[model samples]
Target: MLLQVEPMIPALRRYARALLRDTSAADDLVQDCLERVITYWNSRRNNDDTRSWVFAILHNLAMTALRKYAGTQGMHVAIDDVAESQMVARATQEDALHYRDLMSALDALPAEQRSVLLLVSVEDMSYADVARVLDIPIGTVMSRLSRAREKLLRITAAGVPAAAPMSVLRRVK
Candidate 1:
């Protein structure tokens, strides 16, 4: 099973890191998941949906962690943690300067939209699968995906709404 499951580690890590934003926390969660799988491979052997099972575990763990962190810290998980990778994919160094800007745009998104976008774009999960994973209807998954696309497009297009005047002036006091 190790041979079969070993290849999933990277993808799992990427999804977990995206979800948690904190590398150490993500790593710990993934380790815990691996431990769970190893310890319970016997019962899971009868299940054919290994991919879904793994993601379900990771997603549930992240939610639990999020809840505990929220209760203790009274803080939100910054979307920047998830958007940092998107910021890195820009075409030039100039684009890199706007990492926080991109993050802010993503931060404005509702959690539902963000989760759908992540499942579809990052995890490459199908609409039906994402629906099941999120415990929502398939139509809801599609709707969220559509809205997320609209928001992301508007967000990443160019100058910020409030900065348009300053951007056009190209002058600093």
Candidate 2:
């Protein structure tokens, strides 16, 4: 089982990083996820798809962390505050701008749509597997993915960040 899990580490890390948007926190989440996977290994159904099950575990952990932090002012640092040495040099200015734009568009998506998009496009998971991991119907997964793609296109085309929906915007108490 360990051997089977070894190849999945990079993918898991990428997924976690994208979900959390904080490197250290994402790493800790992945560690916690691995621990849970190890502790509950025997309890998983033998016929279950290991990849889907593992992703489901990671998703659940991420959701819990998100909920836990939902009420707090999240730690956010501006790019100018970071040291120049920490920034990776892109091959071209255009590449860096495009990358930034794409990431911004992704960040603007609702959590549900973003998760479905990342699982399907970034991680290359099937609709069925994404449904299992996200605990949504396959049709819901498809609709979310479609909406995500359309929103990304709109955001990128307009060269403006999409506004968060009213429900997604936290009210200041």
Candidate 3:
């Protein structure tokens, strides 16, 4: 049982990070989710979809945690922060610009749609699996993802470039 779930840690972490948008908080959510799974998995033996079960657990945990920390999301962080965390900085300038455009488009999405889109499109979960994890109807998942992609396409086509990433430390001249 322990070994079965260990392999999912990275994926769980990635999903948590996308939803929470903070590394430490995301890790905490993953930890809580795993603990709940370990303690409760035995009782739920007929679990048809372990992936969905784990996701349902995670979704509940995230929602509970959010209720406790209502005003501390820091206004969803900045658009560049999410992109900078994902960027490799190895692409050509044009590619870099396009990548940034995509990120900005993604960043423009509401947290709910962004998360659903990431789980389904980027994470490659099926619509059913995504609905199970997110605790929403498959139809709702499809609708939100469709809207998210459409918004992204529109925003990127507008050719708007966000400000460059900022340096955290001041350099002595």
Best of the candidates, TM-score:
2
lDDT of 2 by residue, 124-147 (tens): 999999999999999999999999
Candidate 2, position 31, lDDT: 94
Please list the C-alpha lDDT of all candidates, in the order they appear: 0.76, 0.90, 0.80
Model 3: per-residue Cα lDDT over 1-173, one tens digit each: 77778888888888777776668789889999999999998887685588778877887787787778877646555666566646555678889778767766777788789878988886689999989888789999999999988887777676765334435887888
Per-candidate total of colliding backbone pairs: 0, 0, 0
Task: Say which prediction, candidate 2 or candidate 3, comes out ahead on TM-score.
Answer: 2
User: lDDT ranking from best to worst?
Assistant: 2, 3, 1
- Please provide, for model 1 over 1-173, each residue's C-alpha lDDT reduced to its tens digit, 9 standing for 90 to 100: 79867888887798778777667688899998888878877787464467767776777887888777875653365776566776567667666557656656666678778878888998898887787677789999999999998988886785573223333546668
RMSD of each: 7.1, 6.4, 8.7
Which candidate leads in lDDT? 2
Rank the models by TM-score, top first.
2, 3, 1
Give the local distance difference test score of model 1.
0.76
Candidate 1 wrong stretches, greater than 4 Å: 45-47, 71-95, 161-173
Instruction: Write the number of the candidate with greater TM-score, choosing between 1 and 2.
Output: 2
